[model samples]
Target: MTTWLITAEETVIADGAAPHRQIEIIRKVHGNKTREEALVELHKAAKSHVPDSLKGTSRVVGRDSDGSCWILPKNGKGHPPCVIRFVEQIHP
Candidate 1:
């Protein structure tokens, strides 16, 4: 199976407020799928892990040439809220 590395930066809301915390995530996804398909799956997986309140305005960011991916809020400006990187191999 091909391995896909996924990463995300999450913004935590404190007391239900704006811009609370930034959480970084890196995960390995295994499957024989195309890059587009893998991206979709990764988005689904990432969405499943975040809180429901943040679902409607979340997005994924990555560069194929650079082999990087990330998740961020839709309304964010400048850098993404979270950044992710995908790798074919996993390190211990």
Candidate 2:
């Protein structure tokens, strides 16, 4: 079993200024399951729990041991994108 944490991030920009790029952790969940299972469950949780401000932004997916390892855009309709934009091996 594995534990996962998912976060929603966006490039916040001030009025008429440069974007204050940052990645904010919008949600975090822990589960006892295989990596594959955790990913599935986490995605489901993210879809339901992500805040409205992050509804159409990118997401940061990570684990307890490592920092965020994946960043992908949100589907805007309350779902993760069909394609993952980034991924890193979390286990050997």
Candidate 3:
């Protein structure tokens, strides 16, 4: 189970940190996605404009309940997971 320390973004620059996001993750998208592929994937999946800005910052990912990594469409309007709601980030 991977995790991350969501801290002040400046923490890394201030102190040669051990657990901040690396620049490579931003430039190189998930699944080794090319710029075009990444754009398509993000357009289909992301609700908000995600950070592919090449800015030095952390990236948070999320997966299906079964731990499947994908940037696919929503299951449907009335899903069963609606009973309990929470957001968890998948740390790379």
Q: Which of the numbered candidates is closest to the native, going by highest TM-score?
A: 2
lDDT of 3 by residue, 2-92 (tens): 2211211111222465644322111223344344454444333333323333133333334445322222224332211111112223665
Per lDDT, the best of the predicted structures is 1
What is the number of residue pairs that collide in model 2? Answer: 2
Q: Write the per-residue lDDT of candidate 2 for residues 1-92, one digit (tens) a residue.
A: 34454545555556699865454444344545565665565556544554444555675544333322333443444433222111322555
- Of the two candidates 2 and 3, the one with more favorable TM-score, higher being better, is 2
lDDT agreement with native, every candidate: 0.55, 0.45, 0.30
Per-candidate TM equals 0.40, 0.43, 0.20
Error of 2 at 75 (Å): 11
lDDT of 2 at 57: 69
The clash count for each model shown is 3, 2, 0
